[model samples]
Target chain A: MKLLLKKGRLLDPTLGIDFIGDLLIEEGKIKGFGREIEISEKDLEIIDCRGKLVFPGLVDIHVHLREPGEEWKEDIESGTRAALYGGVLRVACMPNTKPVNDAPEVTSYILKRAREKASVKVYPIAAITKGQEGKELAEFGRLKKAGAVAVSDDGKWVADSSLMKRALLYAKNFDLPVISHCEDPKLSFRGQINEGKLSARLGLKGIPASAETVAVVRDLLLARETGTPLHLAHLSVKENLPFLRWAKEEGIPFTAETCPHYFTFTEKEVEGYNTNAKVNPPLRTEEDVEAIKEALKEGLIEVIASDHAPHSPLEKEVEFELASFGMIGVQFLLPLSFNLVREGLLSELKLLQYLITNPSKVLKIEPPSFKEGAPAEVVIFDPEERYLVTEDFIQSKSKNTPLLGRELKGRVKTVILEKRIIHL
Target chain B: MRHLLDIYSLSSETIKEILELSENLKEILERPIPKVPTLRGKLVLLLFYEPSTRTKFSFERACKVLSADTMSFSAKGSSLEKGETILDTVKNLYALGVNLVVIRHNLSGTPHFLAKHLKIPVVNAGDGIHEHPTQALLDMLTVKEKLGTLAGLKVAIVGDIKHSRVAHSDILGFQKMGSTVYVTGPAHLLPEPKEAEFFEIRPGGFKICYKMEEALRDADVVIALRIQRERHGEPFIPTLQEYAENFGLTPRHLELIKEGALLMHPGPINWGVELSYEMEKYPFQVILEQVENGVAVRMAVLLRLLSGD
Candidate 1:
């Protein structure tokens, strides 16, 4: 079969391709790309992508598919379907499921399920510790061999310093990236929201910024000492800036990531006790939001992922403290990250690199590009299209985003993954 | 207002109205027949998720005195133990023609959550370490009854300000009525000053007095909060003994306050930890009067919320 995407502004930062172009696909593979591709074959299919932005499908390194357990919230099928609509063709899901992805068997189960059910590519991230209890380390070698792209105790941090240091070194031997969920459980114990006047006024227990910075400092020092590549996930506080800066100056082998919500909202979102805005490393202050945007601009924070934690009403419809910390974002990842570009914090190509290449590098995988003979993993986005984020608009099973009922720009009009053409 | 969720949401005018209503209601309590027919057939559901004696009984007593029917639901041996969500449990009760809900949950904003979903009014009996709206109202009523007005009074709140919902509400309530609130406790016990600033509360709404004596000196009212031993598992204080010695209100410390200053405690007090037992005998102490005024204040709240006046 011959397929032609005509006259779209194709942008691939990896290949330095930025121009009005046409891309040709044959037999589910990229045939070629040029200023114009005229194909008059017998079985020719052509899609006019006029006035649209086309790029490689986004790769989100952090997402929670909620499968293997708690499929009621989000399974691989629903999660990946949401991702596809957001122009994300690939996602590395976190390991903090009902029964955490600690053992090789769990990782194998996730991959096997992804093979049968996932609409997009799913990379399973195994837990760094057994059951993510922060007590004993998981078998990194066996987990990596089972198709695990990384290891992380995502929902909880490895509080024991010696155990975390050893896990970093041990995961290094297996070539598996160590992703740290930086939070001191003791400092953030029973904490409901960001520690500030908001928490005070609401009378909810506060999670101090030191909870994140303390763990972040410890992890950076551990990475510096061990010389192992480390990835810090969901950094929210400005207090982590100096430590992240010192690590960069020292030439530490580490990559830092912040989510779109970290730059989008602040602790004030919890004013009315809005449970949808409730997130782990709870939404911080406006100052922290500016710092995150600045970090993304300076490339101190390289990757912008959707820490797409989804929760059902069972978890979210309770009291603020009882409500689980999370907001589903895999579906809105691209549109929300596009805000950074809209706000002039990042250029279009730089934003795409953060969504595509930088995250692919974190996972140590080949990013999707319009190379000849490569799989046709592409996204056609209407940058000017605006739509309200509603339950009907969301493809994820859980409709638990604070952005619900709000209008967002940049809609994914179509997604091309190999032979399957998904029109959103 | 449909719901009495927190003191922060109540205006000074509304607070004055409630206090005036309580003063009138307090007269009924001293009469031969203490019952009123204000809410003759209305059913008030007392949903207490945490263990409580005073708050639950106070709400029930308020309901009975107002001639409103009352039903109690405790977390123990209830459907909540069977893993039913609080919303579901409250909805099931709401289906039974409940006129109002007076809820006390270990989680903050549980009453607000219920109030959002239910058409019937919801009253916050006490929620977590968040607020005890009625407790503050009753305390304010006691102060007004004794001192003639809530305005221009100096109030001192001592002990476990961070964990005490009573302190949170009292600070907002007392300040709303034009009183200056001074809070002093172990450094860890007091909330950050930014907490008050976030509410856009006026400057001097509440001051953090580091020294207990500084807070007590020339104070018009002194409220001593109970220190929960369970909360001390994190070593918020070096020891209860050390806390009693330094921050506790003893007879010696009482001399620092104004001659006619009122001593208050939202009780179930840790006898020696926050207050010296000997100090309880002082004539200016209004701890028992605070409890007596609790019923009147809650009665006023139920009438205001349910009767739509």
Candidate 2:
């Protein structure tokens, strides 16, 4: 099968290309095109990218598809559909499912299901330990061989430094990056949201920002000593941004990503309905958001990932203490990032670089770029349209988008993955 | 439909009818066909802005037992996302034909807001510090179930007197049942138990053991409010160390009180804070008994409010 995207302005942030070109595709790879005449429209199927700006498809390194053990909420099929609608072609899923991706079998199980179901490229990041229990390390080499792109103990961190160091050292042999969810569960202290005045008044427990930064400081040190590649997932707390930037300067082989919700809202938004705004590492203060924004602009943070954890509506419909921590976020990431970029917080090119090229570099999976001969994994978007979010706007089975009823600008027009237009 | 919004909405006459219906429902639970078609054709909406395992889950379980469909929506996933002003979110829930709103918001006037907007009756599970009227009704049901009467008895509500909405709503419900209500706690915690023209305060702090002893000595029923652990941060009591020493319920506490005084507590008890673990298991503890009665009383409230009698 063949597909052609005609006369689209290729905005290649990595190569600095901003000119009109035809994206020629055969099977699932980009053959060649642009200056040379391409195949006829009737000879092959064509997508009219006439006035659209085509860029490398966005990728999210953090999303929770809540599959394997719990398909009632969201499986690979539904979650990839959401990523497709939001202009994401590749995603690194969290290993927080019921039967976590700790073993090669579990990782292979997710990859096998994705092949049969998902429309987008689903990269299964295996758990660092069995069931993410933070105990003994799994077979790192075996897991990587069984189609696992990276490894992470995502929802909560591996508390033992000694154990985490061993896992990091073990992963180096396979050249697999060890992604970490840097948080000290002990520092959470049974708190729900951020530690502040609102938590005191709401009478719920508060998790301190130091709970996160303390872990990042420790893990970064560990990565430096072990000479292992560490990727921090959902890096919240302003203090960690400087540490991450410093790590790169020192050549510590440390990289990090932050979610849209961390930049969009804060502890203040948790006044009434405590659960939705209630996530682990908790939402930080406004100062934290400002710090994260500055990092994005200064190129300290590498990529933006949607720590998209979807809980059943029943579990979240109660008091703050009883509700689960996490909300479905893939359906809103692109629009939200666009809102940030349009607000002068980040340049369009810088934002897309994190969405595309930077994530590709971290995962070591090259998404087909806008080069003359490459696969046509492209995202077509318009940064001008404005829209309101509602229940109907969500594509995931779980209705946990914190963006509901939020009116915002910029919508993902269409998303193409592996020469197939998954969203139109 | 599913929620029991408030107690006052049920009149003195209608209240009796609902209690009898609860008795009938209890008998049905014992029989093979525990299922009821009362809410079979409808949908029950369990919406709690506040947390409630018993009231919320029991309502859901009741909906299941009745063979009725149910759906739950917390503030997290709903319209509370767009900020509160332009999005009440309840209208959309109502448009979906939600038969009831079992609301428990932290704000004092939230359920009343639903009452004003929706034609479907609301079951006010609990609203901020204002009232948890159904909880009061359930405590009364528990008393009547065990003692076989609620009239002409002295019932004392002790502990966390200032913040317990359960204690606030119970005084009124108990008074309507012809019981003389007495409210006493640490001096900083209690209000003079309000009864129209009468008022009386408990003397001194938790140090004043004589006052609480006197209050519980002649009581036929004793309701101890659950003291929140968050209050340990408050300057009011001086310290949890001081409060536990004086007010902590112990075996001595149960012995000093009247033998016939039925003991109770609203649960998720802090084993060492206001009440003891022994008090939780005490024959008079009746805390677990309260949880069971909660379901029955809630069934009564749902029947009366939804039947529109």
Q: Candidate 2, fnat value?
A: 0.00
B92-203, model 2: which lDDT tens digit per residue? 7778887766777765445655665567877777766546877887787778878888777778777775556687667656766667777666875664222212122122
Clash number by candidate, in order: 0, 10
Candidate 1 chain A lowest-lDDT run of ten: A196-205
In the range B1-309, model 1's lDDT, one tens digit per residue, is 889999989999999999999999899999898888989999999988887888888889989998999988988899978999888998999899899999988778888888888999999988888899999999999999999989999999999988889989999999999999989998878886556565437686778878888889899999999985554447677877999999889999878899989999998888888899898898899988999999999999999888873
Candidate 2 residue lDDT tens string, A1-424 = 7777788766777776667787777776766557434675565878777777778878888989887898888999999988887888788887878788878788888998999999788998888988888899988888888988988898879999999999999997898889988889877756677765444333345576788999999999999999998898887788887787888888998778888988988887676544567787688888999999888888788788888888776666554565788888887888788767767987777788888888878888875476656766778876667788877777788887566788866677877666466555
Top candidate (TM-score)? 1
lDDT tens digits, residues A332-420, model 1?
88998998989988889999999999899888999999999989999999999998988998999999998988999999999999998
Local distance difference test, each candidate: 0.90, 0.73
Candidate 1: lDDT over CA atoms?
Answer: 0.90
What's the true lDDT of residue B169 in model 2?
69
Q: Please tell me how candidate 1 rates in CAPRI terms.
A: medium
